[model samples]
Target: MPAVTSAPADSQRPDTKPRRRVGRPAAAVLDQDGITAAALQLIQKSGYDGFTMAALARTLNVAPSALYNHVSSKRDVLVLVQDHLTSLVDVSAFESEPWERAVRDWAWSYRDVFSKHTPLIPVIAVLPVTDAPKTLAMYEAVSAGFSRAGFPQERIISAIVAFESFIFGSAYDVTAPADIFDSGSMAATTPHFTSAVARLAEQGFESQADVAFSLGLKALIAGLGGFRA
Candidate 1:
């Protein structure tokens, strides 16, 4: 071998070490939908108490700092989640049906949506509808229905709030156990209540909660109809 120059010591040795990347691996392209989906997954897996920005970042395989680049705070993530959930409520009935019928269908759909995401109820209930476009859109549709029904501008929000309160309560009630009203040891002390419970079942109510919700919703629709001009 004529003048075979030895290779550099670094190159001569086997390349055992992995090449270092130039900077932090680029995080997946974060967006409102991706962030909201991750946050929802965290909530579903760990619930509200366990969900956090850090948890969401980990779920997305990104640093917490990277998560902040998209959502400023947990509330921001929640607003996205709320908007997604609210969009599922059926507002199409407003297009063709009477306002009362539209409200009934929308209320039932809304209650069902939140019932499955019960932990979100409190968070979404208190959050301002500002900046939540889907939530606002749903409200807009509902408000227009009320307006077409001749509800006064001043009373529209109050009526909507009242219906929401009832819907929220019914959503929570869905999680109650079948025996939630069972009066085991106190059965003897409360004849009227116990008898009523028995009568509720005897009358073929699907569930105590369901019956209560139906009764209350019917009354609320009728009562709110009174506000129509």
Candidate 2:
């Protein structure tokens, strides 16, 4: 039989590996733009009720401390998201177009953008105009157009608020069900409403929401213009 050598005993082996360093782990590069994009994605997916700092942190694959390095709180992130979305509204019309046309452009574009993000409406409706620079800038542009058109300063905000109320509700309407007015077997008893729904359907192939929105928006523009000095 051949002689064999025994390996070193477990406790007798030398420790050759270096210990790992304790420092910040590798993470995604974060900034306002990245945070806003991630926050918007998260909000679009889970909505406000499901949005949380910890949830956002997980979405970004970073620790909560890493997220805090940017935004101070959830509300800060919301203001960022709000400003970012508002920046997308076509306020350019306010620069070169007449007040009525500017209002129409702004209203239609604002509705279209928010219609896709209706989940943000509730939060935006109650949100203060402060801390959101882009949003404030949009208001400034629109207000300037209104002022040029002779709107009294005192009533400018009221007129804007009225348009916003209609716009937000219309955004929700854009997402309403196609058969929401079907009425089913109960239609026989609700003749007036049933007939109206039928007439609306026969009007055109354009989206019912679009038709109603256009009608309402025209009425709003003409009606709100009455506020002009």
lDDT top scorer: 2
Which prediction has the highest TM-score against the true structure?
2
Cα shift from native, residue 197, model 2 (Å): 0.5
Q: Give Cα distance to truth, residue 143, candidate 2, Å.
A: 0.6
Q: How well is each residue in 1-229 modelled by candidate 2, as lDDT tens digits?
A: 9989898998998887897778865668889998999888898899888889999999999899999999899889989989988999998998898888999999999999999888889998898878898999999999898899999999999999999999999999999999989989999999999999999889775799998899999999999888887
Which pairs of residues collide in candidate 1?
Answer: none
For each candidate in the order shown, give its overall lDDT on alpha carbons: 0.91, 0.91
In angstroms, how far off is 191's CA in candidate 1? 0.5
Tell me the tens digit of each residue's lDDT in model 1 across 70-167: 88998889999999999999999999999878998999999989999988888899999889999999999999999999999999999999999999
Residue pairs clashing in model 2 are none
- Candidate 2 differs from the real structure by a C-alpha RMSD in angstroms, to one decimal, of 5.5
